[model samples]
Target: MIFNSDTSSDQVQSEFKGRVSLLESDVKQKNCSIIINDLKEWDSGTYQLRVITLPRAGSSVWGKRSCPLRGYCNTLVEGEISAEAGLCVVIPCSFTVPDRIQISHIVWFKCESTKWRCDHGDMIFNSDTSSDQVQSEFKGRVSLLESDVNQKNCSIIINDLKESDSGEYQLRVIGLQMEDALTFSQKATVAVKGLSQRPTVMIPTLTEGQQTTLTCTAPGLCSGSEPTFTWRWRRRGESDTDLTGNITAVKTENVASFAKRSSSTLSFSPSAEHHGTNITCTVLFQGNVSTEETATLNVTYVKEVRITQNASVSEGETLNLTCKVDSFPPSLITWTKVSDHSSRNGTGTTLQNNTFSDSAQLREERGTATLSLFNVTAGDAGQYVCTVTHMNSTWKENVNVTVIYMRDPVITGNLRVKEGAVLNLTCRDNSFPPSHVAWTQVFDQSSRNGAGTTLQKNTFTTGDYLENLRFLVVALLLLMIISVIVVNLRYWRKSVQQGPTNTKSPSGFSNEPESLQDYDDVSNATARAPTSPNLLDDHTSEGEVEMNFPQVRFTATPRRQTTNRDSSSSHQDES
Candidate 1:
């Protein structure tokens, strides 16, 4: 120790002796160390150390000064650092290093784990190695201020923040003092926001009857807590429904930014029932705060068409047909009727046409269209088609229309016949899809019966050729019978006109018709009427009749043979 030159040599020796201990005091190699023991709070201020070295060749003694000893190691003051999920953040810190120490490297680490504890709790950075071993979660997301690193600036700016980044972080300064390397720690806390950013839901073009998948991405890439995703959809004319989805945890980094992106996906098959609906995806974060996104689903689909109308309509009746099409947006519909008909113009010449013209009226509404045919007739019978146009597809449906009618029954047969003659009669009707036919007799209610088929036309009793001949013969025989009766009556009346009286002649015989009374008794035989003979046994007999005339001699076999006093001169009988 060197003191003032005026001080007493004994006093300087006495003050230095046993008052200080110099450790490893090798002057040849320029080694200097000093230690103060039993320090008190009162010793807190700056205290400097001085060393003197002498060369082996008696070089001039050189002196150097050491840094002031502080109360503790270098310190870094840090408050809470706040950041958004997709943005960035900066943690400001500084430290005081002893002047003799040399800085070699800087390091940053994070610790908030429960599973497998990371070495150094996830290495954020290491300045010594350009590409240091970093945790998979923090790689490329951390950076140190290049200009301020050498100036004891331990502050770092981390980009691409995520919910998982919310935790305590400590910075380490690795450096060499003399030949030994040392490390110092400064801890800071980070608070990342999961609700600052909203989720984004993407909508894709959907088709009917097609299987599709949709995706919804949440705000933060990763989360401090596993976030929950819920999906809901509003169907047409139905209540809201919850859908189950698959979740994904993604962590990524690049030169521009680094963050975690969590997403959910839904798969389903769509049809017309799902048209015009809203889909919502909600993300529940660590706290009560949540993020939600909604998108309208515009499903491209076409439902099967349905036609409402009567299948069978009568002729001359109005035909009303309706076609319905359910689909997204709206559909275009057309009604067309087809038929085969010929038309005549002013020149009275027939024009050949197979398809009907535009004579019917068409009406349309929301998803349906109607075709009206006014006062329809047989000419309007054919197939009608409804063509539906939707998106890029076209569909057609056909409906058949038939016109039918029944004409009046026509009688075309003999109306009258003589007795014992066959009568033929026939009834017919011209009809489409025919009608039932039957026969009826005027006198007999039990004779009428329904007999015949739906055939368009029918004939009755045409095969009986002998029926006509029987009719003619009966007509001629009736004339012959009238002549024979007239001749007999005339002869009897001439004989009565002679005015003869009953008298007795030779042989005691009465020649005056055997007395008028006796003649009356002989002529009193039961009167027999003239009757025609049965001509055809095979022919059907509708009815029969009999006549009584005993004096006429018209019966081929008389009921009483040889009455007393009967004349046998009339051998020729009524035909």
Candidate 2:
């Protein structure tokens, strides 16, 4: 029997003897195969085939003896790897060996260097001299590819490959004996890169009379070069166009070559035309490209303006006229005061003093000007034209000034007076322009025909003495009537209050009997007195006394007083 090992140690040993037995001579044949009991990897050294004759056809009997094999032994198979960061990496290793060799155990190790060796099948990792026993960072991360170790496919899968796991890896195999242990190592370098890209914006919209700003940011995994920024406006139902306004883009560096980066800001003033428009920003890189989202812009406005004034005004009174126009730029106002009679092209008068006088010409003011009139008069009253010009158009206001005049005055109430009383009369008249008043009295026919009465016309004057005299005469007559009535009443009352004997004689009376007789005869001797007078005297006798004939030699008789008393007594008795 013959055995041979290629690309390995050159030795021939027998496993049945339990010891190494050296061959006496070198084997010198090619294409040789060797077989031995209990074959181990250490016995896998090179061997040669030799032929020896034992005197039976004794002339160097050689029956196709094989020479020592001179070929390389390949235990390690070519491997393929595929990996992603934060995920698993498969190092696929499969091997085909000579049928004499059996793969007892398969193992995986992080390949630090070519000089270092570690344990293959054990749970612990043994380094050169001192056994490390375990790799702390790579302990749980290391896993076998297949569950069947007999297959000799020593592939490995590493889960959760961290940044530190970005090194080489190797595979090792162990036979049934320690001497049969063989390492078949293949290095696989792992690279951990971050995620692909980040999120972005979408379509933009805007309204009329509004401002808008749009922005798009680049994806997460970009680095080095500044990401190209572009803003494009895609109108609704139309193609996109490049924005011309201000644009800005920025990029920052981080740990890895491809790191977090962003591109942003595209701003513009948009109109309703930009509604439903799409704005986009695109970023480009060496291996990949990304686009920031699009967005729609919405816009709104504040407010606007409308028109102003009082339409009517009175003449001879100041007029305040105004014109208002509605606009964002403040519409211009032009005021024109036009007369019905005038033919002026345009009223161009300026109110340097802000006042329009009666004598001043009517004019127009431009650009939000006010038309004001000061001390307006009757002639100044007319149709005033206020023309407000704004946005290349004119708005007109026609104001009519009405001249007002004071109304005439009226006097009211009746004149009162008594009969036969001299009266002073008042004449009053009311007029817009005050009027002159006069008074005159008309006499009756009887007074006119009087002999010495001359007809005269007098111009009655107001607030004059003659005017006052008429009133005074009426007042004096009323006073005189009242005085006369009062005096008569008082005299009658006094007469009644006195007793009959105490009553005094009225004026024009005489106490003498002769004067009384004379008066009586002159009035009427036969008539009795209207009033009786009481006289107190007791000297006369009661009897009648006889008178003698005309005193012719007749002497006056003196009678005794006793006899007169007796006679008076007799008369009294008889009476």
Candidate 3:
């Protein structure tokens, strides 16, 4: 170290050798300033410099006093600090003034990194001074941690931080004299980042139509400004909607010595519409800094099981039915058909078909299930049941499925019968809802009416054939003629055998009979055979002619009766 004193006996410490120096020529003008090169944080305390003068003649005067070190009025502060928006940060700062220098006030100034000085407009806080010169935004937000600056605690607390508040802060101390005032060259840097701390949200188990409360707590404890809370609901496929009007919101703040607790609680009744929707709790702080937490709302609910479908399906067509249930968590749907036969368990199982190996096909979605019966037939017709199982509850619904069908009709009776016989016939058809069977007489082309002539009844009958009365009379005459012819033929043949003679009988006999008998026999043989008749009569004549011909008589009888009687008589005779 180079000494500024004129005496060559001056000494320097080993640590300060070649690093500390004072100009001797400048000291001649009463300038004893010393320069320290490559100074470090450890070199920041008090330092003294000693100067010795020539002793007065005879009487010696000694001068020993504390030497004030120039350019040593230092301000201790952090180099950098990081803070989040909507939170608080403490910038620790402390400064010292030269001994015997009365401090007037202290001022904090914010400046950009490139600027070396801050104007009066950059002053954020001033101690023991009017606030007219301090920035309006930081007027109440900036406060000293230690109100007594005599304690050397210049640390300040900035609440409700903002992104624009990031910069370099310088501490300036104003003393009573101009030489006592100083501004620390070492400044503290602050980095205010965007709000990243989300609000804490508490949600409870919610049920449909049940009132519930949700709590939201804002982050940080600055105690600068009261944060505002907002509640919003976002439904599926829709925008967010404010729930302030529909819900009750309560805000509470508890301030302690160093921390401030701020929270909000929202109360509302939940419904099915709130299920699966997102609800957000946002906390807004000073400078429009905001943070939010979102949670999905789950409302437990259950609706009745509904089965919709066309119960009546034509045969050989497909039958489709759907069962649905609305609940918080989707319910499980099961399809079943009521068994026509007695089931061992009473509860029916899945539908089964003899023709289809895979009977009813089941398809499931979120809240609905479909049962499809392909190629439906009469066997597929029954009561179909749909069951839904939700949380711990089970619901059921059923429908009667009908398969429309009809079978070929059949007539169960004899097809042929005699004219006078009693005829009976019945028509039968197998079908759903039963078919109506009627009898109709299908007329031939020869009939005046075409096609079927509905008899309007089921049975028909015919009585005696009186239309054949004239024919019966004609038949009787022919039978009588036949009997007379037979008598004449026999008499003629007897006469021929006994030889021809002309004689008189006792009963008015005549001798001219041979020619007449021959003529009569020929005429009788020439007569046509009796026509087929419904009836015939028998009669006979008696006398000498009756004796010669052995009188024969003929009676009329119904053709059908006569045939029957003959057959019966022949059987009787044979027996």
TM-score of each: 0.42, 0.22, 0.53
TM-score winner between candidates 1 and 3: 3
For residues 478-542, write the lDDT of model 2, one tens digit per residue: 66665454344334323333323234446322222221222222212221111213211233233
**Candidate 2 has what TM-score?**
0.22
Sequence-dependent TM-score of model 3: 0.53
Assess the local accuracy of residue 513 in candidate 2 as a C-alpha lDDT between 0 and 100.
Answer: 21
- Alpha carbon RMSD to native, model 2: 34.1
Q: How many clashes in each structure? A: 9, 23, 8
Ranked by TM-score, top first: 3, 1, 2
Per-residue lDDT over 50-121 for candidate 3, one digit per residue giving the tens place of the 0 to 100 score = 665555443222211111246334434323577788888767666666567777777889988887877788
- The regions of model 2 sitting more than 4 angstroms off are 1-85, 100-102, 113-132, 192-575
Overlapping backbone residue pairs in candidate 2 total 23
- Point to the candidate with the largest lDDT: 3
Cα miss at 314, model 1 (Å)?
Answer: 3.9
Instruction: Score residue 304 of candidate 2 by CA lDDT.
Output: 29
- Point out the worst 10-residue segment of candidate 2 by lDDT: 22-31
